[model samples]
Target: MFKGKNRFQSILLFILDLSILISSFYLASFISFGDFNPNYYYYSLLLGWGIIWVGVVLKYNLYEVPRILYVDKVLSKNFSAITVFIVLSAAAIYFFTSYKFSRIFFITVVSLFSFLLLIFRILFLYLVKSQRLKKDFRKRGVIIVGMNQNIQRLISRVYSRPQYAFFIEGIFTDTKLKGRLKNNHKGGLDDVKDYLLTNNPKEVVISLPHSYGDYIDELIHIADNNLVRVRVVPEFSEYLSQRFSIKYVENVPVMKFRKEPMQSLSNRILKRSFDIVFSLMAVVFIFSWLFPIIALIIKLTSKGPVFFSQERTGQDNVSFMCLKFRSMVVNTDSDNLQATKNDSRVTPFGSFMRKTSIDELPQIINVLFNQMSLVGPRPHMLKHTEEYRVLVNKFMVRHFAKPGVTGWAQILGFRGETKTVKDMEKRANADIWYIENWSFMLDLKIIFRTVFGMLFKRDKNAY
Candidate 1:
């Protein structure tokens, strides 16, 4: 049986990607020189590149368009695809043709292809999202097979992100919990086999706790026997860290837990190198000239240092002096107090800076020194950290990466004073997500969002 139209979409994407991959090189060559002329050996090189790129894309699951709308995943996969293509292309040429390749030509081709691929993925996402909102849009049917808090969480998560386009057919629970009040509660564990037979769902998600482990084997047999995919959400998932690494101890499989991507040396190098390059650009281009004017204005408007420095928790719960352009009058309570909305201590000029996030410009220095990242969890004051750690589960997980000047939480309106524990929890969750899913392209996306956010309007809670 066909599992929806996703396979058809994947086929279409394969063809489109192949066309784009070839067109990018042709376009690059035309731009590099005046015309496009290729030898027979070069034609062979293009063929080899196409084959390798296609395989790489498949390896990275690039054709799975719905779940991975994230630009970071697309970019990472494309980068890997291009890398494979380049390596395969080089080997084929070196082993076959004596014709030398131009360095400029290769660089231009790779750069153009990367740029084009990213554009294609972004446009594709917009198209997918719009299409998914249509009344008649085709969505995969998923059935939840157990009763627990996980079922509620799964429903809320699905509702929160419509881009996935998965419709819950019905939540079939084994127990006669409060959830059975709904009309879709087709049956209990006894009726699950009947539900699977009747509903014809593409995927069955099992969320039974370990205490109900006996039902697992039966459910899997039902799901697998009927050509539906089975997904198990282990009960320990809540207690374990965000991500897992699978290793083979000889032939046996072992699972190791981890929090973020920055734990790897290569990832660390990529983030640090980008941080240096970006900080240099900001320090040289924006801050060099702009800082003097801002400093003068601050000195004239407020009786305090030009820069505000406060100790904040960073990666590994280490403390660092967080830098910002001073935007408030001198005060003794600054160390202990949280700035409330329309705080009396905020100067007129300082209020503008805070609203526009201009006071944060000085943190680029922290980025340059490696104390902060261009994107990561935004560090909190020591006091706030201490208080929230007790209130929020896994609050310290945010410290897995170097604190960033801007972060996913801030972009998503989680910044400013925590009016309630729920607000702090939301902020902590966003930070945890960022830490768990760090990528250079995601960092760039966050930075882009932050810049546009600051330019367009005042942050409602910035005081």
Candidate 2:
């Protein structure tokens, strides 16, 4: 019953958005040219824009409202969709069509549509809240059939948010509780079948730990016999650090502890494509001239190689030769000792390069070679990797993606020397967070911040 309502709401939202798009185009025409009648060319343009808008919004999951809706989330999603739709529409016009559309009409249409989408979404949420508050609202009855912290949290969330339209019919657990499960206790596990027959709830939610596998199976069987839907909330929350997801392979369910958006092939492809294009541009425009000057300076000022290559941990904990413009004087302890502020081994010229981040620019070649990405966890020296893997919790989890020239850790001031174990742990945690929550936009944001910091902000951590 809840699923049917969700489907209905999605369809309703889809129709409303398309209607708003059509209305916005005609409205823009009336405002721009003083007539509601638009040309056939304009109509065709409108059709194209409508299709692109649908695709963009669907990708952003705008048709379905989140259970906990925030104003910032609503605005972000709508603005993201609008930006993509307008960019694509403008690109299509510039490339595929010869007819020059009026800039005023295009801007007016997009502005009107964007304004209407935000207003209607807020209005829709208000209406839904108002309707759910009414006594006539039909909330689905849910019977919880287990006891645990997970179950307790679920109950609290449902009861606190009446807008979700769930009525906790009762809770059934084998465990004896005095105060926690007293009010809603319909009896123990043996009474569940009888209560189901009598009450006939819309759904049964099972939240038993793995130890109670037998009880869970029996409850499922009973619920199925009574023609009631069953949903299981896994009790493995204690073992996970973040939200988990289940995937099916050959009809078998597999639970993953962390959700990595980069696991998607489309996202991987987009990141790689951006990396290739951006790296190529850097090599062509910046590196073409800057490399010779830096090499000459290093050679004139130093006694060793201009570039430094060292073994570092890459994706999947594999060893790769990481490249960088040599930023320190040649020393036997280079591999074992990390650079510190005012280090004796760093040359005067190298200090300037390291401070300005010019020393890391040579990794553009690594990106071009497909051994590194534009933005990811910074690769650590082999010694640091081996040492920190044992010291830091989930330290190796950051190796799930290719190491980057500058990463989440570096931009957040976790770069330079790590004098203690806690510093390395902080860097690893940031890297793991990035791996689990990566997006193309996030990479761009990191790049922008890294550049901005390098140009404007003075980093005390950078040596």
Candidate 3:
């Protein structure tokens, strides 16, 4: 009733990828040199190609779970893999030997191979999706162990995506729930062994909470004895989002509670470079002239400094001097006070700045100074940080990455005065979501939405 091995899919994809690579390389060679070389160096380069592709795919987790494939993500990763292969090939050929590699052939092969690989993946995913829609397609049998939110999510995913090759055989849990499938509920933790031998699923998903730690060994033994694959959903898995990543420390896999894209060196460099270039452009084109005019207005309309600096929470629980165009009269409650709508302290000009979010423009300098990101979780006043961290458990988690001037929370309408603890909690949730799902594309989307909102939308919360 079940497909023999899901690994067959990965193996097939691997072979197909290798064939595409080899064909691309040979076609490039024939087109460029008018002849194909089957020499030692050629085979060596092919071997290098294999190593690079496999390494990149494994490093990026291109083919980890067999049935749970993401074609779009795989497409993006394939581009990165091909790019890395090209650069590494160039470096290896440049230093190791005097063989003059044809730049044209290299270019042709790289482009063609990337395109072909992407096409293959796209076709494969579509085929899987469509084929699974048909009842006749062989489906990989899977069983869920334990009862938790993770189990519910797994059931939803498997049932929702019938196009995928996953066929849930049954569920095993100790909890008593009404109207569950017949014989699906195995007695308890002890019965997992007997269930496995009787119903050998190709994959078993263990979705128990931390309290079931003792049962893990038993389930593992059962799985091993039956030659079944086991997938464990970490305890309290809801604390982390879908993008949750794992890192091995001394061969122990540690789950990241928050997904910080900047944790990756490549992501960090890419973000920093963008911040530099963008901050420089803003400072030169916009700040160069706007600052003087805003200063003159502040000096004339208000009896305080043009820029207000206050302690704000930043990355790693560090405090930084956050600069903003002063929007209110100088007062003792400035640091701790939450600004409300139509506050008396707000100057006419200041109100306009706050309304348009022009008051936050100075934080471009913060981004330039590397104290903040252009898009992230918006920094809160130190007082708010301390208060909120007590009120909301995940409040300080936002500090895992640099705070931004305009952020996920702000764009989501969770910014400004929090009249209730729920408002602050919602903001904290949004901030954590941003941190967990940070990506260059997401940042761009947030930045775009912020700009659009500022231009067209009115923030009733802004005083």
Where model 3 places Cα greater than 4 Å from the true spot, the runs are: 1-139, 157-165, 180-195, 198-200, 207-222, 225-227, 233-261, 285-305, 329-332
- What range of 10 consecutive residues in model 3 has the weakest lDDT sum? 1-10
Cα TM-score per model: 0.78, 0.65, 0.68
Identify the runs in model 2 with alpha carbons over 4 angstroms from their true place.
1-42, 48-62, 68-143, 149-171, 174-204, 209-214, 221-229, 235-260, 280-308, 346-359, 389-394, 409-414, 420-426, 448-461
Q: What is the C-alpha lDDT of each candidate?
A: 0.80, 0.84, 0.79
- Residues 1-463, candidate 1, lDDT per residue (tens digit)? 1136577877777788778768866776677666676444456657767877767776777777645366567676666565556666667667877778765666777677777777887788788878887878777788778766666777767733567677777777766756423756766777788888776788888887788787888888878889999988777676664667678999898988765677878678777977898899988898899999999999988787999999999999999999999887889888888889879998999899999999998999998888998888888889989998999998888887899999999999999888999998998899988877887778888999999988997788888
lDDT of 2 at 141: 84
lDDT by residue for model 3 (148-216), tens: 766677776764477666766777777875554445665666677778888767888887777778778
Clashing pairs in 1: none
Residue 84 in model 1: shift from native, Å? 6.9
Question: Which one is best on lDDT?
Answer: 2
Q: Predictions ranked by TM-score, top down?
A: 1, 3, 2
- Superposition error at 169 for model 3 (Å): 1.3
TM-score of 2: 0.65
